[model samples]
Target: MTAAQFKSNRFDLAVDTISRADLEEVIAWLRKYPRLTMGEESKRFEQAWSKWLGVKYSVMCNSGASANLLMYAALESAGRAGKRKVVVPATGWVTDIAPAIQFGWQPIMCESDPVTFGLNMDSLAKILKRDHPENVVLVHVLGVPVNMTRLLALQKQYGFNIIEDCCASHGSRHQGRLVGTFGLISVFSFYYGHHMSTVEGGMLCTNDEHIYHHLLMLRSHGWLKDLPAADARRIMKKYRVDPFHAPFTFTIPGFNLRPTEISARTGSIQLRKLDATIRRRVANHLIYQKRLNGAVDFARGIPGDVISSISFCAVAKSAAQRRKIIETLDKKRIDTRIFTAGNLGRHPFWADRFGVFSAPVADKLYRGGFFLPNNQSLQGTDIEYICGVVRKALE
Candidate 1:
């Protein structure tokens, strides 16, 4: 049975992740000082994020797309390990593929697992065996954690760099470790609809000291001033700059993608409630698993992985069937969407340039998969009713 409150309302795919109290807290702080640019609050948020993600450093930026760009730029600037080819999943956002091409790196797209919606290791292993790409960008699509233990083993055998894109995944884990900590560089998005929200912000995380410094420069305008004290001195000695000019030194090509004090303050407040948010999202997702497991093609978390469940994804048996299901959901006042940009390989941006390589699994998802509303604000009845609509549509 539908809840009385929800009977007359259209269920939305996302809600404002920011709480009213958190918004008030930021307003009160802003009124007191009026300084909203990147500052101590940004630093505080970065440190806290690092601690939570089990990484050494986290640099805040304007958006997750910028975080992706900064990561590729940093790797390119540092001179990648004699390997120019980067492998990315075909089922990721455009930013994931665009940055690699923009930075002059050759990116080969791989198929995604129908269940996890991450790079299929078998498919990736085949590409690694044939082409031997040095870098792999792994997106934990829709908050489902990839099996890192197996992926890391393949990394050891293949000797490649891993860039974990955890933009849709916060508080997600593979085994016991967090998703963002298992790679050379990790990225997160704190946009309005994600696990947490800073309104419009992202973070770049790394454990390596040099890469950390590189990210700092990339986030700002490639100035030595952004470097830590010792690192700044090292740069000064390397360049042999005048003491007065050292502070103004530009080390590498960079951009102005810094976050504001307002976003950082929001992030700080939102981070505290992330655990509770995940609990609600996961609980709602379990209803989908219990009710619609064999009836529809839904995203499934790998064994021993804790999913953040940003949304519930359903793949209809055919493209025509998907359209009918969406129509049914619409009539039921349920909202639905395509699965995360729907296979970047099939899109015009990639098709016009490289020509589309057949990624059967990703292509199938592109044609048939649609997203169901799953968020912190959804309750038991909402989840059940949404899934019920799907079951009836199939009937």
Candidate 2:
């Protein structure tokens, strides 16, 4: 049901979780499919996502984290098997950096633009000129697509690979192109509270033939039997066959990261509703922009880029005030989340292990930022009520 149909008392945050429909799909798939989890549903999910994102190929893994690993593994599988350095923006989900660390690739950290909250172009240039990593993990922070036109131009000059991190971005576009398409390999998260979900899933997309096949092998046991690709013969020759075929073939070093059939079906159902979901989120965002003129402070720095409204993000003037806002909203049954990872590098996870440090732009975002209850099902009145609560909170 639409939020407008509910009673005014229901103004508080609707449950921050996936829909019943998603649950039902997963259940139904389990009942119908003999193998509760396998490769078929994953295969279908990949095809659907490719069509949705306008990419030629996709690889589905058990989780978004695994997808990132496969994206890098595919590169390593293609014989770039050295300490490949990857330049990445400092701000993003923790898992965004997981693959680089796991695969022995060095991560050259860059900063984010306070404005777009994507890559800070100036900092990126400095790193590109100095460190010159073989890759860049361009994160589309909070669904704001990076300045791809300029970044791609630089890519040509520098000749490094791009891995678009779409963990928080689903329907985002940059210069009329989908955010995930710019990178040599794009990665997405289907985690709960994202644009879509399969409980927990992720996808890797690309048009490259070798990378595509390598990813297929990398997701499973890195074996020929597990991955039934059209280019299996080519892989056999490339990996030197060990003279074994079909029934038993371990062509390359691989991992058993296959996703479940149930999860895949759930994701497929969710995928069907993606465009509509995106529209609802876009509409709700417009409502906030129009009505919440003076209710609360904004990040005020985004580069006027069209964001997918991954979250209804804002920056309250004071932490105490933000706390009060959350308290009030919670009393009203409303839910809220802190802004993106809250200065991610400051956490011990990065500092102790990677020797990473924080930056000025990220530190500020940490102290004042938060994301409100937002999703495709949210309606105009729901938005109005949310903004109303924010106005009340500010007062």
Candidate 3:
């Protein structure tokens, strides 16, 4: 397509990473009348995912939210979820914190950092001193890598397990390390319009062997069927159960969050093109940052870190300015939306439980943060044009 023709089309906040060719592959596989349930395809996708993310194990689930739920459940099942006091981010999707609340953990809301838009280290340190929480969940907000250098130092001192919500940050890196690799258990989403699409799916990844075993059982029905044969045999010996009844044996209380073979097959196909997608997104994001610099505020992230942003998030000077910019974007046929959840604390789900989470950076993001298109579909020219529209709106 010509550049002008492409620009004439709607500039979306996200675009499906899956192409017609990918769908054709899926269709061809469907003709085989293969097992649609979680089977070999799911295993292959998980293995491919683990290798890509540099993790030892990966568990595919129904959705990213399901992966978050599995992370909490895995912690508890492994007997490592101490105190049930988990620190959650103020500027992330609700799922980042909701699982903590649903799992009956005391959720302490942390402020957003001015630069990275992830957890504010100062706020987290204060919480560590005060609440003494055992776990902290953070999102690489909008694919901007959190300041893991500081967060990891805090983890060492305070000794809290890190649960990274990388659902929107598939290829983000901090200090040359992948975001998901830093956490005890990290989650990624493969829903439509994300880094990639499996139609609907998520992945839970970890390096710890014990946590890996628990994730395998918890992803299904807490049965030994999915567990490694060696692990299953050991468990059976411990319970004095015979091999005949082992597969049906229940271990920990689990949920049915299995991904279908179709989704898994789609995921494997999408994974192949993910690196190219990341490259295009990274280039587009740089264009946004360069052209819009000083004209608007956005997460700068830590220096030297790679940001594989899903969308180019910018904060207008005020709420009125944001409305004006968004209006301009809409008029120009560009898609835009308020930042992810604004502040999760402002939502009724959180407000009803613990009063509005008030903080300088987070409240500002709630009032002024907005998203701009930064998917793999957009080119440098498209981003520059979008930036021009935004800058004109600000004037």
Candidate 4:
């Protein structure tokens, strides 16, 4: 008898696949810390993460949003919190802006070129006409660099700090530098569907000692009371105040955004396999671009930029065609979505905000924007099936 052909239904593909080693790591953590103490697991995870990013420090938290929040909060506590505006990608997730608001900083959202799926430096240039903010949050959407070179040049000219949001861009590299290392304080997400998974976690990194210490304190409660005396002195000198005394002295106003022991343990195991995962994902993108070339247009990196494809987003001939194509793909149980929230300018909370520019390009793409599954777990057959399904939908 002939063997039945392998097939996976929508139900089978509903969740992302977590490797056995990943699962084993979590189980082992639970065995070691039944109640999940925040200790060695967390410390080891931070160390592993710093080594992975090639940065001086890596701070762990419960989620990427938390990571963003902690980074901004650290900046705030270190004294750039108010009267400073932050330039952010006008095309990313909502949490990307939350940190700015939570820290009392004005968020100047910049439009992105939907074609390139990266930040539009022209918009940034226009806004920086007067004076640049001390903190410029440069979020790399869908694993693509946001004109980092130009942005960095502008930052150097105006003296603004760069904060790279690599939540969807864990392994992405730009000019031989990892995404996280490019910014003063960068963030990474290990959400289940990301390039790697620690179930749900985030990391914050920086080469700056002051930012690193502040991030550590803000990850927990506002109390720097438990920090080393010399660390407290360093912070005090930066802030020009005696905020803390000896033990139990409240240093900087902070919050407890700590990661659990399991998350840390899971992250460490996953880090070991990150390079392999990224290679597979990158290979899949090349094959995807090759197979779907004529049928689809793609985003090219800047003249000297290298991109990491977070999602396979594309422009459709028309909005209706896009919807129909999405429906057709849905019928085949192939999950897909828009590049990033359609466009940030259209959102009610942001649209009515003061000082926000009309994101014409990003808005146009939002109407026609769509994405397809680019998960590393997808096999050769899965890619072929996806391409086949897309062709049918287009037809």
Candidate 5:
């Protein structure tokens, strides 16, 4: 490809999904001089997110990484983190497993699935059988729904709690059910490039009331101020605390991972357009899949699942081929990156402490995976053009 051709078409790996109109909405809200901290707006966003996600409760936090931390904290606070041994995926982001290490939990890494690039069921089964972990954390890698059918069956058989990281998998579904709804607690990111943007925000969702209460306390300074009135009163009475001091009472150790009213306001605005954004991304992803079929290998996902991908991840035949394709994409002015962490196990964070995790699929992804643009801004033709660039590079 010529440099002139590169200047003609530019494709970004991530285009901010938050529109000018959405910013206008935030500006309007700001002009009202509303409360800008975690208040009514945050509550509204949480409720809206819960309703949309088909979950009973949702807690908004500063970032998805914090949400992951809170998930581990809540699990321990609620006495649900048995043995503190968790099964984490080798293909997911580091934060998915970092919290385990931070909490001094024993994290057993599982291999990536060949089809969905999620946790390999056979590998997870092996972990469950041998390790008997208390929890299993899985990411719907790049918006492709994991094999939830097999995963759920394994959960039933192994009796392990499930925590899902749906940060990049918004609107993805497995067997007509949403990805986040299946886990004991699921986390979502509303970062700038995701399906929606709250500037820097995330949500922790769950149907368990006890866990929900624990999340409220864990989100703040482990205080009862954010808890429901009845629950707070019950806690106060149990501890023989006075009403004056109950609100400030620290229940369990927590952090100030609170979202600002501005983020919450933006989230409310972005939430309105989330479904539309998801539809566009999903459509664009399918176009990439169909066009790049045999030219490069990628996740096919399950037959009935929906993929609302943040980026289309493709695996070249070899590391050399991947380098060539990335070079071509760069020359074409198309933004691309190595697949999300490729293998967290190979990263220094994990490798320094534990030896390199070697598995066929994970190692292959580590060497060959690359991300292509897939955002709400791209259309079918854009995807086709990108695929053509990749196919030509392969040739």
Candidate 6:
């Protein structure tokens, strides 16, 4: 914890996943075609992402938050706003919940499962029984896939639309299939600290063609130009507009959330390395689990679920122990963080409007959850050292 410790190279929670070669690849693309914007490169990246995730369509956007916004907006546009309520997990980034509320949808906060750090079925069942919400924003919290088998069954019974927030989960799988493919629409973040990097970008993936067409329009300025020629023509024919005016036509209200050619080009290069990056992350996570076994309390994927492990998490038995552990790790030159925005409902933004609802599991996470470094850069030795620090702190 001393100043000298700070000067040393610590096992930080995130190392830049984007390599120099990836940057050079982007530069090469730019140099080859200097006129860069969200065009061919963006389309190429979107196609690659769709193929990787096994989805019919993928739309690249400026950030994950924008992806969420467009997803919710697409739902609202599809006329689900009448139900007005959506179930959200207690543990996840604010953006996951914010866009829902911003779109005038009521957010029913559900408690987290200590095992998955996602919406616990018990709590979610209770919410579903009570509210019968038409939508559920499911976050694969920190790359640990939710109990999708159970959740999907519930979804079938309840008839709620599912939006999988895979913003932090690039390669995570549930039931042997990718996480994003399970829901109607899924999002992924390629920010600097995520599983991969586009410097700043995100993606929305879906199998639904209508949603896909809407997403294409929504990512841009809600114009017909981004849509498929047939789809755009249909809209034009319906509105009685000429081709000249079609370029300037605005359909649904939207924002320009498009990513640049640079981001997309960089993402295309980064995508090539994603599998290796995920393998290293899994390796480090296993090391953390083996080393920190019995000392920490956090979720791990079951047999059919695979975690990308953006950062390995450890939950202390008590709030005091959690604080001590964080301070101790800092002294040892290790980086730690609260698990992904811990209990979005506990934050002032939601609490002020909703009047402080209680979610025991999320509250437990808010008080005790902390993350350890787990990324492509971390070696087995580094993971061992970090775990040793954690063990000492717990002691």
| lDDT (tens digit, per residue) of candidate 1 on 139-257 | 99888888788799999999999999999988788987788999899999999889999999999999988888988987889888778888899889988987799877898988999
Compose the digit string of candidate 4's lDDT tens values, residues 1-395: 00111334541222343687668767765776465756777888888888878998888898998888887788777775546688777777788787776656788887886445667877778778765667677777777767777877887777777888899887877777778888888998888878777788898988888788788777777666435568777756766665544344457677878888877777878888788778766665666666777876556556555555667666676688789888998887777777678677677767666544466767666778778767666655566667778888877
**Order of candidates by lDDT, top first?**
5, 3, 1, 6, 2, 4
Give the count of colliding residue pairs in each prediction. 0, 4, 0, 2, 0, 1
- The candidates, ranked best first by TM-score, are 3, 5, 1, 6, 4, 2
Query: What does candidate 6's lDDT look like per residue over 59-90, in tens digits?
Result: 99999999989889888775655577888888
lDDT of 2 by residue, 119-172 (tens): 788888888899878888877877767888878888889878888888878887
lDDT of 3 by residue, 183-289 (tens): 99999999988999999999999999999999999988999999889889999999998999999999888899999999999999999999999999899888888
lDDT of each: 0.87, 0.75, 0.91, 0.73, 0.92, 0.85
Candidate 6 ranges beyond 4 A from true positions: 1-8, 80-82
User: Where is model 3 poorest over a 10-residue stretch in terms of lDDT?
Assistant: 1-10
TM per prediction = 0.97, 0.89, 0.98, 0.89, 0.98, 0.96
Residue 162 accuracy (lDDT) in model 2: 82
Off by over 4 Å in 2: 1-33, 80-83, 226-230, 238-247, 293-305, 354-356
- Backbone clashes, candidate 6: 1
Residue-level error in angstroms, candidate 6, position 390: 0.9
- How many Å off is the CA of 340 in candidate 4? 2.3
